[model samples]
Target: MALTTEASRYRPSAIWQLRLSLFMATYVLGASALYPEVFYTSALIYSHKFLVGIPVLFIGGVCCAALIHGRRQPVRYALDLAQGRWRGCLLVLLFFFASLTAFSTYKIAIPSVVPYYADNWLADVDEWLHGMPPWEIVHKLDSNNWSSVVFNSYEVIWFYQWFGTILFVSLWSDEIARIRYLCAAALTLSVLGTVLALALASVGPVYYHHFVGVDRFHGLNAALDRLDHSYMVREPAAYLLKAYQSGRPSLGGGISAMPSMHVAFAVLNAYLLSSINRWLGVLGWTFAALILYGSVFTGWHYAVDGYASIVVVSVIWWTTGRLVRE
Candidate 1:
């Protein structure tokens, strides 16, 4: 057989393919299991999106491919990558997809298989979140917007997951499965934390479980759902809806409380920001603030969960920093 090229020689194509294969392999295997570990976990409630997500994903794959035709020049770069030239870029994408999927799968795989806490917190939270009351103008600040500037926060905080694998790849391109493992680990924790918060904790702020007449301000909750509608049967860039639309706040609701991953990812971004850019560190703080605000303001998470999530993400960041050796 003729050699593809030296680039292909060092290229971790095999690992890439393996990562991609194993990524879905484990997910599908677990998803297809008669009864996944999650089923017996007694955490999630009703789960239905799994089957719905497949065909939507297939169509999305076709869409993304079609979209890529416009950016085909990058194909040469990818070819060079196949030859192992731009492993960082390749790994970047792999990390993003793998981590996102793994984390998502881990959190809800159990619920879909055999929703456990469907009646406990999942239903309660859903009933509570049925409709957000009009924003209260307690203080006449910014027209009682109750929202703040949050400069740079939105970008810095979100950048973590969006670009986490990319940065990891840039540093650990030489390390096989480094990004993959990191992604897996992050995802595992994400799912774990999300599940615990939603199902195990089964107790959010004073509202979800019981109405205290206190506005939760979970606007993001609804916004998230709106965006999810676009992807529910499409590409689902981040699989944002996996947890939502699952019936009763969907699968996402099943694991929506304590140790909020929103806070967790923000913490991760802040940690990474400190290393990549100092100004970004400042933004990381801003991002954390936004997340904290969103949690309480939106009533999606408890203040305690925000604190716990911070701790979790901090540890994950510290540990991952070492793992990637960056």
Candidate 2:
């Protein structure tokens, strides 16, 4: 959609933008105090990624948008940017990057601060809730062909959706809805991704054996290994394990299992997209469901982690909507 002058006029004040930045700043400071070494190292790593990756992604997004909107819209898009009508969205993005850096840093530090003591408990809870390991239920879908789809959806597609949703809402015409989305997103990452993550620190099913000294999920791992298309899934988990062993902050290095952030963000995206249109809403929710299943199927999380994330994100979405409207 083209950016309109009426939408620009209704853009929320810089205060909302400042709130997001301030929250990130505060989180960074607190986390730095707790683990200065990790905070500084993670900052360096993630800063470089954001610097190189964001421009490439933003340009790609612009190109795609131009193609979708047709040749005539590029001039208007450039003019909108030139006139500073999109400044709020840009500011929101800047703060978002900052928050993400802090979140990643804290995620890496979770094991150092809290240790992985909750995996067995969470696994048992999963068994109790589902009458068997959640992976058992999801693994029923496992096969060479389906594994490829799940692997890409869980890793590659989720990355696009995460950034794509931000760009989508950034360009949305409704200022209030945009602010509400930004608020909810910030809270979800900070509260669910970091704070509660630390409080409920666990290694998840995939890493349960390594962290807890038990091969409880060996069957699950073996099943994944047998799937020809699941190398994408296995490789990253190995990389994270190496990073965890070295005690060095690498890109996407942290490992906290309880309350899967993947599922959390997917749920958040569903809520935000649904507010825009029903069809997009259906697409968002479907993707959310897929990620939820993939989280368990891939052994990245217990079933309850996704369940809790869905509930918590819904509450955050609703609460932020009320707060922004007031």
Candidate 3:
């Protein structure tokens, strides 16, 4: 084929942005119609949590892109970057908001779709493998203060690495092809993971312990209770419990866990980071490993949930890679 500078090649197409925005609009409207309270709550959370970063990163990306492509007068280059990279930044913002909103909406809707808890089957599968759930395997470690610290801190990977990777790819990276791949792969893995989770949703071990009287995971339950008293991880679980008890709409309170999106996103982050830089990829993989272990150790998901998520994300990543090239 042909060679071109990074600034001159592989930018996202307008048609691609148009199609993605259309899908996002449809999802937001449909989700609002189905569950107005959940949609609104999620939107509010998104606005507060992620909206501030958009402008900062967008401007930074435009300046960087302009600097990279600076072959004209300063004012002229700034205007050109505004017309090009700034526009792309806005598109990236739209895609990010849309993807996150859809994810939160589906998380809220999961309980409605699968009303009954299905952890018994998953727990059984774990037992079939080793006669005990994965958390129990780590039960001995929970006694060590550092283990609790690690498990508590491990949850940060979900937000830090996942969102950080998105911003890095969209704003800092010169690889537009990588950005497109991530955009497509994120939606694909999210939708598929939600579908699979909804098919046979479960409240997971900790929730089951508190809500359904499944005493099988007592060791894991105790560890979570201890973490609640000291660690930041307890806050989300507290919110989930309150939402479950009050039956009120809350952001990120739903508890479906058949296939762990935490693990899926971790896998996607690792894959995308690997595509760009080896050291970044290693960091991403380290975070993924922690999340893979944390998903089971904290009783948020069965061991099999993480396993299945890895497989699913791997398939989507491979498929999206090919599609981005084409």
Candidate 4:
């Protein structure tokens, strides 16, 4: 389906714009007071990553839009960003920045606030759900190809799909649709997800095993160690282990893992894509399932974390959907 010609003219809702601006302003003030290093570091890091990725994103968007709609569609989008409708571009950038800030706040503040780990209770919940820890089952799988697939899907593919969706919708979809996704995502990742994560903070199986001498997850540890030796590229788990070993309070170095943002974002993406088409929605959901499985397989989260994330994001998406309709 094509974006409506009238809708193509971007005009953001004043209320949402003001709300977002206020949110960012408040965050900046609070972060500067409580965590000055995180405040500046997060701003620099997120801005650098966004700016570096924009050129490739823009070129890809232009090419894809040209093939789908026509050259004029891409040209209109470029002009809107540059001069024609700069507010539209500003709105997207603000939403993105706020999203990253939300993540930064969670990563920095949670560890500083809640130093206790909840892996014991969280692991019990996981056992209640799956008769055993999900990681135990996942670690049993052969590590030759599945390991690479799941690890890469969790690490690399997720980033591409997540940012790709944001870039595509911001440039190609009408303003209403784009705003709905942003609002839904903001609530899901920034507000609801972050709150839940902070409230029930725990490092996860790998850290639990490493720090606490809990042998419940030795299977996952062995599998990850094997992958580290086997894979050509450094595995995500190895990198995370290294970070934890370093013991330095780097930006986004906090370890709170009760509710998985990976699963929350995956579910949110699935729902958003469903609005575009059922098949795409199914694909999104499937990818989300893989991410959930990967989270367990890689020992980054308990199954309960992913389960809680699904429920949380579903509620946020439904609530935001109703608000948007109103």
Q: Write the per-residue lDDT of candidate 3 for residues 1-326, one digit (tens) a residue.
A: 35555433444444454555676677667767787877787788777756787877666655655677765665677576566555556666667776677667777788777775678888889889877667877655665465555565566547766665565556543554544665555565456555787787877776777756768877666676665333455567778878777876665666677788888888887887787789989988998888887787777788888888888788877776665455
Report the lDDT of model 4 for residue 229.
34
lDDT of 1 by residue, 1-326 (tens): 24678656546645454554565556434533633453332223222332453334333433443456527565454344345524444444444444444444445544454343332344344435534331121111222122333212332435444344334444334454454345434443545454454355433442343333334434434433333232221232224334344432223323435566667766665665666578978977776777666555444454556666676666665654454433
All candidates' lDDT scores?
Answer: 0.45, 0.82, 0.69, 0.71
Choose the strongest candidate by TM-score: 2
Question: Which 10 residues in a row give candidate 2 its minimum summed lDDT?
Answer: 78-87
As a whole number from 0 to 100, the lDDT of residue 217 in candidate 3 is 75
Candidate 4 structure quality by residue, lDDT tens digits, 1-326? 25775443443444655665676566556656777766666677677766776666666755666566655576665554445334455456556765576566556677668764687888898898889767778777756678888878987899889878877766744655666777777777656456777778788886786655678876666667787433423344456556556644343455667789888889999998998899999999999999999888877788988888899889878876776555
TM-score of 2: 0.91
- Which rank order by lDDT, best down to worst? 2, 4, 3, 1
Pull out the clashing pairs in model 3. none
Tens-place lDDT per residue, model 2, 1-326, is: 35686565455534565676677679868878877888788878877877886666555655566566647778677455435435655665666677777888889888778877888888898899989887878888777888888889999999989988887666565677777888898899989999899999998988888889999999899888899977787899999999988988888888888889999999999987788789989999999999999999888999999999999999999988776676
Q: Write down the TM-score of every candidate.
A: 0.49, 0.91, 0.81, 0.84
Which numbered prediction scores highest in lDDT against the true structure?
2
For model 4, the local distance difference test gives 0.71
